[model samples]
Target: MSTKIKANTDAFIKARVVKGYSQRELARHSGLSHAYVSLLERAIKSVGPSTAKKLSDLLDKELEELFRIEMQPRP
Candidate 1:
């Protein structure tokens, strides 16, 4: 099952700023929806692993620097 990833907002923003990618551009390049990117940035939604990976790759940022990946309690 896919799990939620905790993205460090400040780090994420910094990475994006350094890469000079707007949310829409990041989403498009990452193959994610713009709204999803927005939600992640807003801390309204946790990023999925694949999405995180895509963003990491596209932004060329280290995954750990962007996200706090931890095991979660199963529902």
Candidate 2:
């Protein structure tokens, strides 16, 4: 996977975990499929702006914040 993709996936997973939500819960809350959430977290799929918006809403964060977080270096 590309580094940016990996970074985004990592950020998504980390944010979800920090929110104390399971993948299934996040899927339901974000109107995304559980499998898709898994794929996103695994860096097997790229998230479009719409999906990112849903996730940002579910996380109660700004969309730009989500994008910024996704682009940050992991660890």
Candidate 3:
């Protein structure tokens, strides 16, 4: 089963910004859909390991560094 991952929105955004990748650009680099990237950025969706790995590799970060343990409670 694929479990949802808890991510820090600020960190995520910062990484993207530091890399100079727009959502669409990150989507291309990470092999994820642009809409999905937007959803992730908005915290509307959670990421699984596969997706996280792709993004991590693209960002050149460790897998664990891409996310946090405490997730935002659903609204």
Candidate 3 per-residue C-alpha lDDT over 1-75 given as tens digits, one digit per residue, 9 for 90 to 100: 334775567778888889899999998887889999888877778888788888877877776776754445565
Extract clashing residue pairs from model 1: none
lDDT of each: 0.83, 0.71, 0.78
All candidates in order of lDDT, best leading: 1, 3, 2
Report residue 62 deviation for candidate 2 (angstroms).
4.3
Identify the candidate with maximal TM-score. 1
* Per-model TM-score on C-alpha atoms: 0.82, 0.67, 0.77
**Model 2 Cα RMSD, 1 decimal:** 6.3
Give the winner by lDDT.
1
User: On residues 31-66, what C-alpha lDDT tens digit does candidate 2 reach at each position?
Assistant: 889998888777677677677777887877666655
Better of 1 and 3 by TM-score: 1
Q: Candidate 1 lDDT (Cα, whole model)? A: 0.83
Instruction: Give the clashing residue pairs of candidate 3, or none.
Output: none
lDDT for model 2: 0.71
> CA RMSD for every model?
2.2, 6.3, 3.8
